[model samples]
Target: MEYSFRIQLVAIVSLMLVFPNTQGWGEDGHTIVCSIAQARLSNTAAEKVKELLPPGNDLASMCSWADHVKFYLPWSSALHYIDTPDNLCTYQYERDCKDQNGEKGRCVAGAINNYTTQLLNHGTDNSYNLTQALMFLAHFMGDIHQPLHVGFTSDRGGNSINVHWYTRKQNLHHCWDANIIETAEERFYDSNIDEFIDAIQQNITKTWSSQVEGWETCNSNETTCPDIYASEDIKAACQWAYKGVSDGSVLEDDYFLSRLPIVNLRLAQGGVRLAATLNRIFG
Candidate 1:
């Protein structure tokens, strides 16, 4: 790299060293997705999920359970994302997923399909299986919509791209994961996830709501088509998440303001699709 670019990269990495909260979406973002899904869930689906979770755990609260258990299930860490090749901004399950050490049917798309099958079988399996399936579905649905989660493999889905968030220093992946949603909530709803979900609930445009069927229609055997949802995130990551961003990028109000609609739409779609999947399983 050129000397100037190298210097910029070092400066950005230094910023990341100081900033905190670099995990996926933090708890707040997951809560928004799960809360929306919980509100829209059918009574039957709601009852079904409730019975599977431990006492005092609902979809919203248990949304983070997958992240917790992932520590124990080392093989499951790959279940959270599908890393597309660099700059292409698209996904072919065979092209992207197989490269992660040849684990077939085990990435986010595969996990969704696997868990969906398990949930549909319902009581045919142990409660442990059922609960694990539910948690993965709840979490991965949100993960799929997080654009960075489907980003370039070269950058580990943007995790390696150091940039400053208005001089605070964070990675591009972290910016999408935790910053954008948090900033959007505070700006639009005063940090009220409930209110944000409610507004989305009321205004779920016909186009996006219709997408639930479109996404589910993807055929598993048809090359990349089966994982269109993952592809969607990859496209978003290319167009918006990494479009203007580079090493030493300094993000601020203009960037956040422009991205709010994108964030909200993804959250809304994630919630609705999650409900649709669960309803299919339980209802």
Candidate 2:
């Protein structure tokens, strides 16, 4: 009887370990890390973006460009968590420990460094290299815009904070990543990317200069930049934390209303800024 009980116990333990529930692993808000990349190519924008490609015998370039952009989507989203050392993978976590300078140690900053080096290596004949550069520029700009990506060391940017979202057990980190954006996306325009972008661009164009300044100011304190997390109250954070949010809460229906507008304005700034960087590099 004792031997049979031991065998059963071992089997149960193995089963539990193998089939551990992952539903709650990332249930809070979206990380804002990988989601930034998803914003790049909506189903609506794919055809439009393809239309912008150069003509005649450039099939390889076009395909390469598409793949390059797609590749960065995951990185763009993942890079948001780079600043938070605790949230990083074990390998990255150890690497961060070696850097005494806080900013230099940050994953996002490291990604920036890596990206710069990659951008400077001019030997590659990959036709999609330019697109890769542009996509990186766009996605990184958005990543930095999200404050939660620059989270604290203690809580791993709210990853440890147990919370509830509409009766379902959740955490703070996943909430920002999905609930907020998903809510907004569903509530706002008919899930149209171009329209979303147009609306967001129109809304932020007049004040984008100030918005950039605000992000710069928030990021000025290197020690604090990586320690902050988005607030529990998504509506309030959108309203108070960012310059564009006038009301305390953004209605679910109105979420996409501002997304593309914001993306468009950011892209415009990124393109111009990227051009300036290139001019300096090649001048």
TM-score of every prediction relative to native: 0.84, 0.43
Q: Which stretches of model 1 miss by more than 4 angstroms?
A: 1-22, 205-226
* C-alpha lDDT of all candidate models, in order: 0.75, 0.37
Displacement of the residue 266 alpha carbon in candidate 2, Å: 8.6
Task: Indicate the residue-level lDDT of 235 in model 2.
Answer: 24
TM-score of 1: 0.84
Candidate 1 per-residue lDDT, tens place, 1-283, comes to 3345345434543443355323555677777889888977899989988877655768887676566555456778888888777898778876776436776777888877777877877667654366667887898888888888888888898888888887688888888888887777787789888887777776675546665555434365331232767878888888889888888889998888887778877877778778777776776
Model 2 accuracy (lDDT, Cα): 0.37
Model 2: weakest 10-residue lDDT segment is 22-31
Off by over 4 Å in 2: 1-106, 123-138, 209-283
lDDT of 2 by residue, 1-283 (tens): 4345345434543453344222111211112222222233444333333332232312122221212222324433344444334433222344442232444433544444444455555346343243344334333433433444445455554556565544556555554444444454455656453454444445434656466434323244331121221221122223322323222233232443444343344334332333333322223
CA lDDT of 57 in candidate 2?
Answer: 16
Best by TM-score: 1
